[model samples]
Target: MPRTERPRAPARAWFTGPGFAPAPDPAADPAGPRLVCFGYAGGTPSVFRDWADGVGPGVTVVPVLLPGRGLRSEEAPYTEMAELARDATEALVAAGHAAPGARHVFFGHSMGALLAYEVACALRDRGLSGPRHLFVSGSRAPHLYGGPDGQDLGDDALRQLVRDLGALRPDDRVGSAYLERRLPVLRADLALCARYRWRPRRPLGCPMTAFSADRDPIALPAQVEAWRAYTAASLLHRRVRGGHFFLHGPARLPLLRELRAELTRTAEEREPSWTH
Candidate 1:
């Protein structure tokens, strides 16, 4: 008798739904450059609430919303770096955010920085156009990615770890109802980072800007500077004053100012000129 072939499983749909929110400005220019943002572990899109208007006009701020948070709170959160990166890349393509000739920049903090880097790599591997500029904040280079084993700790211990890292205010109780509610999500996010293993690839072609905070224990200046090796294009390392969560405090204004300046330059470069 001839051998029979077995049925194959259906391909997984990586593009589940829209992965990002619209620009904050209702009247934002459709043709303007986009500033795509991704936040830290267990963070919601609200982290970038003020960025839309803060970056000024001519740029649209689009925040990437991860699962298990905000409106996506019902969805199961991703706990693997590769799977999340693949899904995010598919979502961006389906949403037309990564279309050829589209001008956009990627900004991510902490765990978000790793996601942004992986997504950018995925796009390149698929022969898709990647971000015009890559902005990684409060994260080490992909190869050097490792953190405290917070994911393995108990609920109480994990809560205390985050609080000590400045994720919670000094006065905020570790057992607060709000923190308790987000604890699981935070654990899963931390696990995603812990399990990541870096693979070598060609350096990214787009320019990169890395931000390091003076008081950030997690991502030191040396670690942030290591990002230079991952990009063939120019790398600009900006050392700012504050802790790991500086983007949320008084230091945010100056950071935004610098970001605005860069975005303005990018917009001007992309503008079509008419020669008379």
Candidate 2:
């Protein structure tokens, strides 16, 4: 899909479609980077909806609402990683072209981080220009070794994992509706996670920044560090307070500040190559 293609919108797109809504002049914000922030399996664009404003101008954060959530409620969530990546790449191209000249970035958390990484590489393979920086939060490296088999996870096991990871609990009072909607999405997301198999490949050339929690059980430092094997891009990792979803926690300010600095550096590095 082109940047101008309408995203399968949940609501009758007042603007046209998901990715093309409120199209901006990608050229005007040459330094004004266009971010396609993906969410964890069950997550939504609302997670980083204000990320652009918070990160400051010159950077426009566009949280990607994967199908089955937000406005595209009718669509089913993508199961295959490559398939999701293709859809994401198309959406990104749409975002970039619809916006022109806007530098691009891919940001994802957990499963989303994985999605972002895969999509970034896919864009690279397709010879399409991609983000200046790859900001991955709360995830393990693709090449990192070891883990229990996540694929055989039954609903009993799946639900336990979610709650154990503190993502959700069906029994937890309140937010049941929220939990009801998100948990299935999370389960489907985990299915992708469990089935994902990484083969040895060349590392991505873009600079990579990873965010982790001091208490993150799913992604430990070693796993996070393993990301180095897959990235020719300089790898930097930051550990903050919070279990899994630290991005929403208090550490966001310092985190956002660092993100701003890196994004600025990346844009400047690419600036000289620009014709306009």
Candidate 3:
């Protein structure tokens, strides 16, 4: 019989797991607050790749890379929001950013918003420090996840749904092919979101900001406003001008300004010497 050899794993696999994947810019300042970000369904950390420059150098934008995508493509995707949140919390600890006095913020988009909220809760439940602020974009309230959605659509319907959400275009052959390869992961994430049961817990102490598109079907103005109930502190809702994927291109500047301003406020509060 011919000898069979197992393929070797990628060199960076060790650092590319859930929550700990490398951000576009890995620069660190022990005193600077960390902005941990989560992407939409089936999204990679690349969603926030260009955000670091826009956010300025005072805050470190850490775009989380979930499993079963990007560098961890070989790994299985998570099917539950709680499990994902727990893993995110552990990943932060493993990365040494969860230490005492560490200032951190969280930002999540669409399905990522739900994951970020749960993660903040998980951190608080564990007696660990939580983010100073939570920014949720393009998602409804967590408790409203029980709404009916087509998580088991046929191939054509699924593709149509993807197209409707602006993830696919009529003329982008390569992009279409890439989305086809990612459909399974996308379906799993959608199923998880549809089936999520929001467990009632004490509202988080951290303030929250919800960003919604002026006309997003997935998340209407009322749905986004409902997120205020999850936070005991102040909750600000901002309406941007675009559809569901508004944060993708030039439409992202307004949200960036909010992130930068809030981060600057936190920095100045912590250390008055922090330059504006």
**Best candidate, lDDT-wise?**
1
User: lDDT at 245 for candidate 2?
Assistant: 74
For model 1, how does the per-residue alpha-carbon lDDT over 80-103 read when each residue is reduced to its tens digit?
Answer: 898888878877776667767767
TM-score of each model, paired residue for residue: 0.85, 0.81, 0.86
TM-score of 3: 0.86
How far in Å is the alpha carbon of 215 misplaced in model 1?
A: 0.8
Model 2 misplaced regions, further than 4 Å:
1-22, 97-101, 144-160, 168-175, 266-276
Compared with the true structure, what per-residue lDDT tens digits does model 3 show for residues 1-276? 994443433324424644443432345556576788889987777777777778887666677777778877887777777777777777776665555677778999999999989988988888988888899999999988964565789878887877777765346543367878888888888888987999889999988889999868899999999998998877888888888988765569989988887777754473332222
Q: What ranking emerges by TM-score with the best candidate at the front?
A: 3, 1, 2
TM-score of 1: 0.85
- Give the C-alpha miss distance for residue 181 in model 3, angstroms: 1.1
The residue pairs in collision within model 2 are 3-94, 7-18, 10-71, 26-99, 26-100, 27-100, 29-32, 32-58, 104-131
Better of 1 and 3 by lDDT: 1
In order of lDDT, best first, we have 1, 3, 2
Please give the CA lDDT of all the candidate structures: 0.79, 0.67, 0.77
Candidate with better lDDT, 1 vs 2: 1
